[model samples]
Target: MNPKARSYDYTKKTDVVHSEILLPKNLSEQLDESDIELDFQRIADLVEIGETTKRGKMKSSARLAREWVLCGVPELTRAENIELFEQFAQQQSEEQGVLSMVFVHDPTAGDDMATTKAAAEGKSMAAPDPRNIHAHILLLTRKLDVSSDSLLSLGEKSDSELSNDERTRPVVPKKLVGTIDPETGKKIQQGRGLCSNSEWLKNTRKQWADILNERLEQKGIQPVTHKSYKDLGLTFKPTKHLGKNASIAERMGVQTEIGKYNESVNRYNHNQLEQTANSGITSSQQQIARSQRWIDAISTGDAYIQRQIEQETQQEKHVNSRIGQGVRRRAERQRPNPYEQQLKTSADNRKQRATELRERTIIFDRASERADRNARYRKPRINGVIGEVDRLTMKTALLFSSRRNESSSYTDRQKDILEQFANENSLVTGDFREDIRVTTTFFSDADNAQTHKHIVKLINDPEREEQNHSKTSKFEAESDLNKSTRDYVDNESKTSNTADLSVSIAPRRYRRP
Candidate 1:
């Protein structure tokens, strides 16, 4: 058979028998060495029969005692050491309700040292069978009162500040101002303050509870309260548990009931300690969990923040680049040009003005020619030149001709017409008429009246006309018509006087009259 698969059963008559103890090397070495002698028989005597000798048991009674000695031993007798260890176990049970039997069985004599130290530190070390180590441990396992002084005093205790100079510190009672009697000048200890209205009374409850808690802490008692100081200050209902007699607590025996209430309160607080211990996680586990959550949250938040910052930076860079490009383009296009727009406008206006001036000058020249042609300063004239025959000569010539007798004998009307024409022609014999007629005929082609007047003034000088028209024949032709008019009148008078006497003498030869 293989050594790893060996099995041995030891029993007798259907009752389980004790198996041979197999100690580890260190325990065997201590058992064998004379100098490290241990009282295994004595340890067996201390244990209950079933605890040490039962078969199929995981640990034996003697092994338990031997394990304790193998670890570092404390400066205590075997029995005293066991009692100290038991106290630790009891303390653990009272504080944490789930009793840890494994902690009690921990194979370390250093744990015994801790128990002995706890005794010195004013913690209970009372265990069963004070002379025997195993019996004392067994009695502790059954039940024991564990002193909590060491645990309660784990942290630094608050100490009242002491006056360096020996003057007494004033002790003031916390009460409303109106609670002080005006006449007696003392606090009205019997009743509530006059100013203890609803608001003040609400706050007074918390003030009272704080005073109570503070006073209790002075006497080494911790107060356990569900309501926070802020809640208590607002509203506190002690009467729900105390009833209406709460107002007259002393006379109604409610004071005694209140004292019992405080006692129960202390026990309840102790119970709460155990409850809280059971519910709380170990310090190491709590710290690890809290740190992990915080790290996860912070890492996620930091990554988001970093991404946002990077995005903003990228956008800013893009915007800046665009702005820079725009500025560069503007700079490239920049130039100084003379404003041709205004110059073009001015040139256009000047050209238009020149065109208008030319048109105006043409109009003015036309108007000047028209004014010269129609000049108002020229004088009128009448004359007996070839183009302007003497009006009287023409008229006389027409009358003396035989055609005048055939048409009609000269009536008075015809004679008047002939005379009127002679008068108007200025042929009624003015000194100026012959010169005017000569000058008028000379200036007939002068287009304007003013030009006619100038030429007439120059040429109509009597001496100039005589010099200009020196031929006498031009004057004789014009004078013939006037001489004929005088002859015809004389002939007409002789014929009328000779009548019939001269008829036979032959009608005198009729010449062209």
Candidate 2:
């Protein structure tokens, strides 16, 4: 009820077919049957009368009585709807420690007179409309205060004294429980007041819908929801509710302004939904085409590489066989001549040189063959690693773009990773740093052989022990002054608000005092 209203006479309307008051179980016996009976005038008088405070001020309008319209669907009978509402009222009374008054109304009850007349004349009567079966639930915001078994009063507390647990005791709207008042520098606490929260209405709607649906399902009827189209993620627009005047006009075949507006909104919503669905389909098709092209390119590249590797292997084998035969013929020619002692020393030296060269050539050939075998086995794995890196890079880019308002620290980390990869491969360009094939080729150059070996060791190490050792050495080389400066800067940033200022002071020459 509005506190400023002149009267609360709406409860006395003729549409109220039945009315009853509900009380908490503990206080049920305290009131007489006549006192507990639903009388709107007496209830209003009780609500308006409040205790005087310590400051000698009458606390009029200290309590609120909220009215809820509990609707019934066509699937429910009038008796079932009344029973459901009664159960809900009792539950509220027990759990929330409040008083409830339920009034059931049937707008179609007037049609019963026509039905009775038709029955007397032996004529059939039309089915009554089921839309007007609803209940009005009046809930008291104040709990009953029981001092003794015989003494009962209305409970009221100052806003400041209300604890976290007691905040929800009153049938008031929820607010920021401990928000401080800027004007008074005091926390705004809970109190007995009118509900101002729109969220409360939404919650009540959902609760009533849930209750109705549960009862419907128990009776093997189709369940319904009370959510709006937008809440349910539906594209359709909902029609506005027509009041009694507009409803009467609409029934008389008149097109109301609201009806025309609703039709326009519905048409616009349908066109927007169609456009969105078409755009989504187009985007999905484009993505599919791009993925197919990538797959074809990868397959073609792998086939070409396989042919190249086979051709190189055959040429290497031919070159190695020729080098082996040439070394053997040189050794045979350099064999010692027992009859010529002078030439024997020279021949022995040549044979020793040939043997050394043959050993070196054989070792190089074995190393090259091992490298070829490793490359062949690792090619697919390398491609997989490259693909994974590409995916990660794209994901990072998208994330960064979406969160452009975020701090630059995240972008700095991405840059650090790219720089490290580039340094490992001895590459000047940071672009394509995530591509494994590009890095491998850059590291395979003759000038970068040592760097390539280090990178290969780093990859095989898995735990990066070598990198940690290098970091330790670098940390040891850092000067104490640099560390102190960094610490000072961090501390100043955290502890002080004022900026550092540079001051120049001349050296003072001290005289005998």
Query: Against the true structure, whose TM-score is highest?
Result: 2
**TM-score, one value per model:** 0.17, 0.38
Model 2: per-residue Cα lDDT over 1-513, one tens digit each: 234446434533455567788777766765663244436666665555544455545466454566777776655777788888887788667756777899898866544444455578886655445576888888777676645444445675423224444444444345755777689797666655434345445766777778888887787554567777677454677778777566545544568998788878866764554444333322332333454455555555546555655665665567556656765676567656534643554576568557756765675566556656655665666565444434332323222222222322224434454457555545443333224334444433435434444433333231343457668778876866688889999998866543322222445679999
TM-score of 2: 0.38
- In model 1, which residue pairs have backbone atoms overlapping below 3 Å? none
lDDT of 1 by residue, 1-513 (tens): 122223544221121111122223433443455343324343333233323334534333222221211111122344443344444334333422221231122222223433354467876543212222221121112111122331111111101111222113233365643387678897544222223234433443444345445544554433324355345332222322443244234333335666577657655643443333223211223333454454454445545545655665575567556655755565456534335544554575567556655765675566555544433221111111221222222222222221123333334444354345445533333333333333333333324223433222221222333444456656787689778987998888878768655676765677996
Q: Show the colliding residue pairs in model 2.
A: none
| 34 Cα displacement, candidate 2 (Å) | 12
Least accurate 10 contiguous residues by lDDT in model 1: 151-160
How much does candidate 1 score in TM-score?
0.17
